[model samples]
Target chain A: EAGVTQFPSHSVIEKGQTVTLRCDPISGHDNLYWYRRVMGKEIKFLLHFVKESKQDESGMPNNRFLAERTGGTYSTLKVQPAELEDSGVYFCASSQDGRVYGYTFGSGTRLTVV
Target chain B: LAKTTQPISMDSYEGQEVNITCSHNNIATNDYITWYQQFPSQGPRFIIQGYKTKVTNEVASLFIPADRKSSTLSLPRVSLSDTAVYYCLVGGLGTGGFKTIFGAGTRLFVKA
Candidate 1:
């Protein structure tokens, strides 16, 4: 089976600009998640999606960031007026169920905001 | 979600067994201990997970003591390819979903 696919493996944008990272999870997976890791920091949860509905978005950093899973197939994370601190690797993951099973993560998108 | 603490780094030789331990003193009753391995420029891959006692898979083994305060990930005959950052996560499914908490993790470097 094909693993999770992320678009624009690497992106560099100017500060105050907008950028969107896309993730196409494995087929038939019901749970999708977004995470980010800034330089020298551990990976941190951003949000989670169970189908088209958001399950948890408590980890979102601020109002400038938005995530969407319109058809419950693929997801996108958008950062508006990006800041230098937004530069990091963003990862997308999926799981068969939100239970005890392991999650599969994508290669991640390295975002660099100059 | 509980927090996990592990070594910053470790070194081992090829064909040797490597064990990385993680401590979660505040682990809850329903929480499960999971480990993930991540190579540079790549996302993390699942290695093994266990609630208590021991669990072994093709890639690695997870040993969780009865007290559940800590766990160890054991890799047998580690090769240079096994060199990566290993993360220990402690959490369970919440009403919304599983919000996994990742620690700094243990960086294992296997040499020839």
Candidate 2:
């Protein structure tokens, strides 16, 4: 049980730059999710993927944000033209099937958009 | 989707039983109550979950009243490592979508 793993535990980029966060879920897990926590705010869901197809992405902030799960294995969240508000922690989670309970979350990627 | 309310912070001593209650009066019938623990610079981990009555695990216990208006997460004989933020989430996996919303969370500081 490796749990969920996230790449680039921390990332720093200039405003208007592009930064992509990656997540590798546990083996044989078909359900993957993305969540973000802004400064002084609660963690919010960004999107979810069941295998390679996106099951739900209604939580995405705006057009600049994009999430993809290639080959139904790993997920990537890309933020283009990042803004100052984009500085926050992005968390990835996974569960069996589409169950809401018993989800395992990644340590999260701290993105600092300067 | 049911919104949850919990304390902003709590303080307890080692070897003492800690109880943190969450209010979710509008919780739906199909929704479940789940609690998570998070350390500094770490992701949230599942502790316990219950829909009604009581549920116990090696790590913690979840108590839900008959009305299901609220739920309590009890940590027994906590240690310094238990000092972290605890989150209470209430959501149902409806076809509409998943509504797992995290609140401010209660920061439990365990002292020796």
Clashes of each: 0, 0
lDDT of 1 by residue, B8-66 (tens): 99999999999999999999999988899999989999888888999999999999989
iRMS per model in Å: 2.1, 2.0
User: Can you give the DockQ of every candidate in the order shown?
Assistant: 0.65, 0.65
- Residues B2-101, candidate 2: write the lDDT tens digits: 8999999999999999999999999999888999999989999988888899999899999999999999999999999899999999988544358588
Model 2 misplaced stretches (Cα beyond 4 Å): B93-96
Clashing pairs in 1: none
lDDT of 2: 0.92
For each candidate, what is the lDDT? Answer: 0.92, 0.92
Count backbone clashes in candidate 1: 0
What TM-score number comes out for model 2? Answer: 0.97
lDDT of 2 by residue, A1-114 (tens): 798999989999999999999999998988899999999999999988888888888899999999999899999999999999999999999987666665899999999999
lDDT for A31 (candidate 1): 89
Give the clashing pairs for model 2: none
